[model samples]
Target: MALVEVKVPDIGDFKDVAVIELLVKPGDRVAVDQSLITVESDKASMEIPSSHAGVVRELKVAQGDKVSEGSVIALLEAQGAAAAAPSAAPAAPAVVEVAAPAPVVAPAPVAAPPAAVAAATAPAAGASDVGAHDPTRPPVGLPHASPSVRKLARELGVPLEEVRGSGPKGRITVEDVQAFTRAVMAGEQTTRAQAARAPQGGGDGAALGLLPWPKVDFAKFGPIERQAMSRIKKISGANLMRNAVMIPAVTNHDDADITELEAFRLQLNKEHEKSGVKVTMLAFLIKACVAALQKFPEFNSSIDVEGGGDALILKRYWHIGFAADTPNGLVVPVIKNADQKGILQISQELAELAKKAREGKLSPAEMSGATFTISSLGGIGGRYFTPIINAPEVAILGVCKARMEPVWDGQQFVPRLMLPLSLTWDHRVIDGAAAARFNAYLGQILADFRRVLL
Candidate 1:
């Protein structure tokens, strides 16, 4: 058979990319164009696809191996009549009849459980059936679930086996986990109630008729040891420190009158129900930011060195990045051409990108080339926070919790929905006056909610 060595192809403008994954193993058959390995560079990630259909004979590289162009990655035995043909030579005289090729043997069948045992071990109501929970399935967990659900289970030390599946095809879903959490919380509450109902007796109870505190031993214990920060944690910690030290962050706290915006979002949600796009205040903010960026292009610019001095590099296209927190770390995935997309399209794209990010499925391309960034902590209650500017970007905006505030209306006080906006900019690229002007424009856009749609 013909053996071919698979070498790394010419990856554009990149040298020494770390291999993140190997898709094939020795003796495995692979089709043409199937991905053989994945490489991650500082700028982006790409997969190397096989050039021909063949059986993998040897894999030369493993995960985390730094490779360059023309590096041999694997060896393959090509499939075809020509590759399988024996080398040409003088024919030998036949001595006797040749035996037919041995019959191909089938794989051993899995042993089935006894009938009585099978009946006894039948799954409970709403539980996965036997053999349905295959351990050899994809390493990734079930689909269409939120990250918080998985995190909650791990934190609470809840085993997946004890939880009932409510999603499609007996798959465990977020709602199911949340339900289990609620049950656990209720059980704790009941335990507290029972403890409160128990009769109190002790020195404190005899003196003041109140419940007595339980005694505890303060014996010597083993010393606690601290470990060094992980590589990813160290990087995150350094980035946070750099942002606080270098970026001139100023918090201009103001509330936006979002009553009209809220109504408009609800109306749009009804109109776009068929598209499965839920209109949100964040989408409106994005549109308003895009408009403001167009008017004040300086806010959409980046800092670059020129002539021994820093220069502001103005970008023509608007790529707004959304900060997504994953299990491993924080990742900002950019949404390209935010200025060109409508509210519905923006919402849909944001939802999909956020889902992918939380699942660690976002590629490096999605994490790079952001001209601006927006971080929203409004979902969790907070008045305002001075968010750090993402490096290379001139400006970053933070949206805080929107709440009802009492305001003076000429004659009387009135309650109105107000949202806080915080902005941080690079002082090297943008001056205080320019930053204030940009913030003022953003505030005005947010105040004039109808203008966002136009």
Candidate 2:
């Protein structure tokens, strides 16, 4: 059996990052997208997934070793059923396709994964000649394509430089690459420049007329040490940048009275002390948010941009995602079907997910498919702060620490524990009046949670 070399996917702008953890060894069988190793940059870490499935024949890199895009991560010996096409007659096809040059020698998907992950690895048939993947000769000045699109390009044996991006900012998409692969299989002649067409100055960035990012050499003034930015930080930073720059966001700050609710939480904690279930305010918040979402369905909805940006996707199910702080970087692990879970159950799951996040063991699936998000800085003190909306999600609730404040009850001021709520919403999806009403309704729920029954 022939062995397939599994190479590292693009880690966006960074290079030669240290491989901090090894997830598999020789003789171990692995599946597609199963994390092969965890690589650490300066401040945080991220896992690199395997592109092919098979028995691990050999290991190419070691812990503490540096890796970059196109670097081979492992040697996989393909397994049963789907392992014959690419390894068969490798030399004859190369000799026959010599007259018309194809830069990438995309081979058959010798170990195709299940239908769920098939789109990411399955190569288009009759696309190109079978040969060794050339890591050094990547097409120069290739336009930007996401990791997923790049993965598909590698599987299809199509050079990204030769694929035109039909998406915004001349970004290449999976569909665009698929179309280009069909063209290549038909032996269509096209120039590289023609294949990578785009509007000048990009429709989005040109209007800003932004200046170049500052480049400073601090070493000239004092001694300094350089470190690579952590993988998680880099990934999250990109998302944060996109959310901050693109979204028309507005933050509405209001306070919720939770004095009575706090007392109830303490009483429940005492009753469940023997069972090891410690109820917290967040659990109650989740329940209240669900009820509030039911009251105002728009808050539980996402923008329908792909369907011509004319509607909202009101989700029938409620899955709440809460921000969990970790040593590496911030990650949000969602509690699926949160509407059906009780306060104790939600609290236990929150503790479990937070533990996994701190250990850097949370899977990508655990952090995805969130309809709404809550970023709480209650443990750590803060009055109010705006949280960037997680894309597709139109709103995020930012919870700050509670404080005892004076509230006027008719003629006299009384001390009350007020929980600050900073609700940041997309102005395009929600207006000021609706946001105010949402906060007021949520405040009412916290003041007397029995309103949820109503």
Candidate 3:
């Protein structure tokens, strides 16, 4: 009898994906290439296969554990079977196939944040990172949480110590903070942590100045199927809730004349057809946004710890994220330094990233670090949409399908392609005047690409 360690094969570019399910337990027989544990990346979920045929001695990985290439998955009893030694990085990576539960893709966590945009980069320290940005917070000793988790707690006004940790080593996760808020909103003050923020004049103080969510069973009304949301939708749903609830968002809708811009795009596609690069209107939008951000730097800023939640974090560099709709769910893939790239390059990168997004192959680095965001329903066709602002980033630009309509060009009526623009900004940091100016300037750029040059 030989005891051999079962390690995760090369997962390729996925250095730290969550183990969502364990397919085998101790004493279970596993054949070579048999799926062992399921790990989920932010966009796609895959099953890790066993490298050897053996009886499982002990499971080394657990659900919710983060595993990477060569991470031990289990210990196996080889039973005198001769198995080739596994390489440090296997020549062929673990196959990325959707498991039985269906592939998971949350809107952001559980970011899997646009809190992950902040939290994913945060230090998983044992102590709270709250004191760094929040000067006027409560005096209670800090709880063990990542900086992003602390940020979510501060925004929701939740006491971290009160929320139970479900992560490894009792680390408070973003979901924990969200769950605490949901509990309070449901009129269940299971703990006294929220007492400090309780409304002064309240009815019995049973809940946090809110009514509980009504529990419902929809089956009585019609036929129902219990469909699970992709892991992306769950994570993003949490991220969107945090941002939408915390930020004082305001939307301003306007239209851009993209008749000439559309013509230019068509021309670019014709010229680049030989090179296999097709230009999209989003490329022009990205460039136009870069110009608008330059003209109104505050639109590219974030509300932060500098002013004790009253200040702005002005980003000098421009990184723009665009919402991409996938069969799984909606994901935002970003373009770094839009100001540095041309229309052709942006379009090329856009194609590559969008392909990766559609294939569920986008990495975290490609999705995070967006200073601003754009959500376009152009291809899908919509007049206007109010997009939620991604946290840390104060503004989002929403674009809709362009339509041709008669316009009064001073003397006569002319057909012009009108592209609807919706600019949503955090009212706390940006006033109505600034939001209007940002949208107006953006329209001006789309109307004439020459404005981007100046």
Q: Can you write out model 1's per-residue Cα lDDT over 1-454, one digit (the tens) per residue?
A: 6788777776667799898667678987754444577677645456675655579999999999998888888998887643321422211111111112332222465443242233235442343333222223433222222223333344344455555454333344444544444344222222223333444322112212433233333334655655656545556565665455445666556667776677778888888788788877877888888888888888888655331234567899988997776766777888889989988888888889989988878888888888889998757888788888886577899898888889797998888778888888777667788878887877777777666656
Error of 1 at 98 (Å): 79
lDDT of 2 by residue, 1-454 (tens): 6588878776666688898667678997765555677676643345676665678989999999999888898999866546433332111100011111222233454544243235344442333332222224444232445444554455444577756565433446655665564344323433334444522221112213433223366789999998877778767776775577657899999999999999999999999999987787888999899988888889889766544366788999998999988877899999889889888999999889989999999999999999889999967899999999987788999999999999999999999999999999988789999999999999999999899879
What are the lDDT scores of the predictions, listed in order? 0.64, 0.72, 0.73
Task: List the lowest-lDDT window of 10 residues for candidate 3.
Answer: 200-209
Q: Which one wins on lDDT?
A: 3
How high a TM-score does candidate 2 get? Answer: 0.60
Q: Rank the candidates by lDDT, best first.
A: 3, 2, 1
Q: Candidate 3 residues 80-192, lDDT tens each?
A: 55443344335233335222232223233231212223333444435453322122445433244543355456546567766665453344665556556655433343233
Clash pairs detected, candidate 1? none
Q: What does each candidate score in C-alpha RMSD?
A: 26.4, 13.6, 15.2
Of the candidates numbered 1 and 3, which has the greater TM-score value? 3
Could you tell me which residue pairs clash in candidate 2? 42-228
The per-prediction tally of clashing pairs is 0, 1, 21
Tell me the lDDT of candidate 1. 0.64
